[model samples]
Target: MTIKKKSRVTSLAAGRPPTARKPKSISRKATKALINTHHVLEKKKAQAIAKGDRAAEIAIESEIDALGGIEKYQLASLQGQRLDRGGDSSHILMEWLNSMDSTISSSAGAHLKMLEVGALSTKNACSASGFFDVERIDLNSQSDGILQQDFMKRPLPKDDSERFDIISLSLVLNFVPDAMGRGAMLLRTLDFLKQPDTQYSSGLRTFFPSLFMVLPAPCVTNSRYMNESHLETIMNALGYVKAQSKITHKLVYHLWVRKSGVQCPPATFKKTELRPGHSRNNFAVVLSGSSG
Candidate 1:
């Protein structure tokens, strides 16, 4: 019996599993390769999104969310810099205009008058934009022709003082939070714009005078007011032709021109309340970190 028991114990000892080996750690090179693969996938996905691929967009966005959406992905990218979407439209506008025309020349450039709403400085206004005169205005800022009242709270520019050939609405539209308010704000802005003065040239091919406007990207996509199609339709109805458009992650810049003879489409937001304070108030309360 003892011999039999000894044999059983020996068999059990022999059957016992060899010491388990430790799992291998990922090598630094392998880890880098994995990360590179991920970035490659994301780049492909981003390219597809640029081409308006919805599926790719969703996939990438999901990954962005998994990796902490707001932190991992920037809203806009330009020349290796990240920009706050809707922070400024002037740079985008400058790039777009530069693509078509050279910077402002002193003699003829004087004929081009520009208006910059929420304008902080004239730095990129006239010279960079190829404009003759640039009027910088902010809320309640009545010094040196800078209207000092809120765009919605204040009265319209007294007489022809508020008119301009080009109006930069950079980052302004996004201020208004409500959908209808945004639409109303847009309509009201139109009132300040004048048809480009074609009186200079009589030829049919002469530069058709038009209003040039630069606004935020969300003006088309975000809000309850409408979608891109509706915005285009509305602008078209107003007799404004979309002459040019540029979209960056941070901002959207577009040129709108009203032909001399075209009648504006019947105004939809004519009676819509210009919630002048709504946008400002919302930002003031929500984005308190924003400086004066």
Candidate 2:
């Protein structure tokens, strides 16, 4: 699909240099409405693509365009993350990292390299803290430092030297329109995370590869096909041991450490109802060809 030259409005919202143009002021309620509606339309578009329903896909595309397109959706998301607004989630990630190892913040030698997926701002807490060497990327970048690239399409590192010490997937998994895609995304992380060299000792375990993930609360708490336990099962099967987690009324945060040479469990997580509430959402993650 061809993306037109960025519209004037999009250019203002896009990740241009600070002098380009400031985004227009938009109320939080309006911003949220745009984001939520865009998410609904995106899911519809994904389903249409899955079924090869070109007509439905085009119609959904029209709706998304009317709703100001993916560019606007990304802008609203960035606004919502402003310090005066909900505050950047990366603050939580920074907190968890320090809590895990205070030395991580002070040790210059431990300048951990990080890949921040779906990044909206280059000045978020992690970037500002100077604790991590952050490489930010988004499908639609909104700042000068963040790369306009799809994480799913990024090339795998050729070796451990090129792999990152940490990978941040904040609000990224939920944005994936399908469960299988989410699973594949999770599995793909293993390929980019730096595996420890035999010469390295356990003393520097704080620098080991890890995944810092954040998602909206309902994706786990109120979904019929997913919950905390189910998510744990999937991550465990993928050899990620939960190191830290925090659940707020609106979001869930987790830090997962990769376990070298761990065996994947033969469990299959299908879209069966684990919770019996009619109000539950349809969020789920499915590993391909895995069986109980």
Best by TM-score: 2
Q: Model 1 over residues 1-292: C-alpha lDDT tens digits?
A: 3555445545653665642222234444453344334444555565676699998878876775675342222121111121322233466555545543532332353365666675544454344554446766775342355655456664666655556556666655554434455555555655566544534333311222344454435444443344455556656655567777776553456666665332333444322222343332121111111111
Per-residue lDDT of model 2, residues 1-292, tens digit only: 9988854644543665654567787789998798778878888999999999999999999999998787788888888888798698989877766665555644546667899999988888989887778899999876779999988899988877678888999999999998888988888887888774423336446436789999989999999899898898888887778888999988999988876533444555667789988898889999874422
lDDT at 19, model 1: 28
C-alpha lDDT values of all predictions: 0.48, 0.81
Worst 10 residues of 2 by lDDT: 196-205
The count of residue-pair clashes in candidate 1 stands at 6
Residue 185 of model 2: what lDDT?
89
